[model samples]
Target: MTTPAIPSTLDVALWLFDQSRRDDVYLPAQKLQRLLWLQQGGYAAMNHGRMLMPAVFVADETGPIEPTVFHLFEDSRPPIPARPIDQVAENHLVRMWRRYSHHSPDYLTKKITQQRCYRDAWRKGAGTVIPFEAIVRDFTDLPTGDQMVRAGDGRALKKWTPSAKPAMRRIR
Candidate 1:
């Protein structure tokens, strides 16, 4: 069996960034984790296939802005095998966030939200198992806009869509 062309962790982070900007919301890091968890079968829908989970951002008491929750519809699906939370968080998502935290507090907050969202959602039946195939279908059918550019050779490229792209500052 050939390996699937699922989005990399970086790809997902970039996508989340775009989504947050488009929605005019800030998604904490934990929320990104939740998104990954749901996509990776954090919910019972993994048996079927990949899922396309939808997320929404909301503000908390801190007023710093964060992803309050993930809206998981019965129709969404994920695109990869659901790995253990530690593996996904520690290895890919969190690692990437740490690399950017020094210059980007917003990114750090979004990462935090992803984690919180996952735990909260899991407690509220997001992890209930379902027909894996159905979940996969949901993922496949979800609408994804062109958030990245591709070279003629099919190499992925980052296209700055935000009005003013966030600067990359050295982390101390």
Candidate 2:
């Protein structure tokens, strides 16, 4: 089987930021990290073990985070400069944002941390890397894994085209 191309951290972050902008909200970097983690794990569960993106995650002071994403929007601000994302990735990201964007960052963090994958990987320590296998294992055990497979099969998020418009809402 062929491996899928992994998106750079910049493209993924901008794609996520673009979705939040469309929904008229700003997703803090902390929350965005959680979303990416979910997106990666969920996709892996659905695609016969293929990771949507190869982002490396580490347990941070707040939660699991991709270091590049953390630094990209570390200011807790928005309007991150847009970056290009391919159609396949954009479709997955759009659905991911639609599914999880409504939750507050703190809530997302709490929810993910409570998951078995995050909890098990976190046993290593704050700076330790969370293995991709742990994440995939976690998703495969949940109902959301089924949803991700359906979303990929249906291409349900293709209708939402991504744009570079700046974020309209500020984190309150």
Candidate 3:
């Protein structure tokens, strides 16, 4: 059997936009970027290293962002044209939204920024590309991360608590 076609970044973004409209809620571009980050990274973590979408995420000041997708809402106004996505991708998107939509944009940004993958990939004032491998490494290295991914809620994966050492920069 042939491999199924993966949806473009635009298609995925539109699907997310549809969800926002349906919920009658406002979803900022930053939150949508984080959701896509989770969708691609978390899905790969659980699916034998397969990506749900072939999008490249960069370490933006706010969090991980797919640049192409971000441009769709560069003005913080979403005018993305809707398009159909594969059923499988649609399902993954739905699950990600449910798992994360409850949190505010700031919360999501803080959560992702604190993670090792985002931390290591980010450079101050530079939007470095967050490689898929880096994301996989972060989750797999976390406590119970694999289990969390299997449960389809990578967001709930255990966080990295700092060890007692020289008090480095304070978090929060």
Candidate 4:
């Protein structure tokens, strides 16, 4: 079994909080959960089934949620000390931020719930676990170029590369 890249979900969550704070954005409880879910799945897809953090996601009525994160920060971020995540995990989290941070919590909910991973879990029953394998399966086949693009509203995602060099400057 591949070990998780990050030691704990809380550390990753704290990193995400720091990321949002750096961006001058406010992260809601639900948004934080959905982002965590996306990052975990994205990390698995990118890293050959290795989990980014030891997070267990359940299908909630709204969307995917990590219960530990939800219970602790349901009202406000608790006083838990933030741990320093390794550079690798931080890099992955930054990639995830670029992918989904612009979207709203509602958008994430709508898109994520439609995914097979979440659908299968919800069909099983409320609070059913969305297994990591299932999530990896759902994400693994995405074209590499589109993996970082938000899967908006169950529609096919268009690849966007911000860092790609300008296309020959149109040969002006």
Candidate 5:
């Protein structure tokens, strides 16, 4: 499937800034742009896996703008109970970290398994917002390994090594 065009950095910046203002969150435009850029590859239309073109326009704070696109992976077991996109967006950064990062807390309690880190924080009255940069930094620093799948008996399947990298070409 063809990848959709990514939004210009400026447009994404503006939209993020507006969303932050409306939601009373203190996110800055630069930070929003960074998040969008990091998430671009992961956004795609459901089932088909076709990437959606991202658009950002100047929008009134109270009026509806465009719906945002998100990627959905098919899972036999849904990790968390279904919820609205806004809530999903708010919680997903931490959820993704828990799934992909090695820096997550070692203890595997029911509370941590059932709720995203920020959601757990809210339940405990901490009322903290984890920064986007912290998530990004941790994700990027994760060690690379052969991607694995689960087998019928619940053990990880054999690893599949990736192909060799292509030679770099010099443009004349």
Candidate 6:
């Protein structure tokens, strides 16, 4: 694939961790992986297949994981040289956090790994790379994506919380 929108994965990870802290929650490594995967999928699906970060996802039996991030964050967050993210990309990530970060780690794992992309890659064998195209397809049709399935009043599907302000970011 071509170069990703964000120069580094740590940039996004830092932003996510900050957001979780803002909400008074601890971000687990597994949950962070799912957010990264979802952000990649959502960005690609909505923005003509451009990736959100320079990361590769592999099926790990448990779920899809950005290996570089998975290993680096395996125990805990290592010393990171966080970089500024593009304003547009930051906006997209903010939306992603609001949309899905409220869900539990197990919930995210089930929802993401159950998709055809993860299933096919995993069936190929553990650590198989999931193509960006397959991920784009999965995200495009996801019921919980921006194109959410409508229900009566749709209030039950809504996940946004009114915040005083957006999470702070070092903009590019």
What lDDT does the true structure give each of the candidates? 0.37, 0.72, 0.71, 0.82, 0.32, 0.81
Ordered from best to worst TM-score, the candidate numbers read 4, 6, 3, 2, 1, 5
Q: lDDT by residue for model 1 over 1-172, one digit each (tens)? A: 1222233443444554454556565555555544443333322221233222332223343211213222221223234334333343334333333333233444444443334333343444534323334333333333331112223344554434776767899999
* Overall local distance difference test of candidate 2: 0.72
Cα-based RMSD of the predictions, in order?
A: 17.4, 15.0, 10.7, 8.0, 16.8, 12.5
TM agreement with the true structure for every prediction: 0.27, 0.75, 0.76, 0.82, 0.26, 0.80
Highest-TM-score candidate: 4
- Candidate 5 least-lDDT 10 residues: 69-78
Identify the superior model by lDDT, candidate 1 or candidate 3: 3
lDDT of 5 by residue, 14-131 (tens): 4444444565655432233234433332232111233323433112121111223111111111133333233433343333222333321222222122223224334444324333
Stretch of 10 with least lDDT, candidate 4: 145-154
What is the C-alpha lDDT profile of model 6 across 1-172, one tens digit per residue?
Answer: 7778899887888788778888987789999998898888878876777888877899997899988888887777778866778899998888878788888999888888779889999999999999888888786666564434233334424435789998899989
Return model 5's CA RMSD, one decimal. 16.8
The numbered model that scores best in lDDT is 4
Q: List the residue pairs that clash in candidate 6.
A: none
Query: For residues 42-90, could you state the per-residue lDDT of candidate 3 as single tens digits?
Result: 6666565676777888877778889888887765546656777778767
Candidate 3 global TM-score: 0.76
TM-score, cand. 2 vs. native:
0.75
Q: Which stretches of candidate 2 lie over 4 Å from their true place?
A: 1-4, 76-83, 143-172
Ranked candidates, highest lDDT first: 4, 6, 2, 3, 1, 5
Query: Which of candidates 3 and 4 is the stronger one according to lDDT?
Result: 4
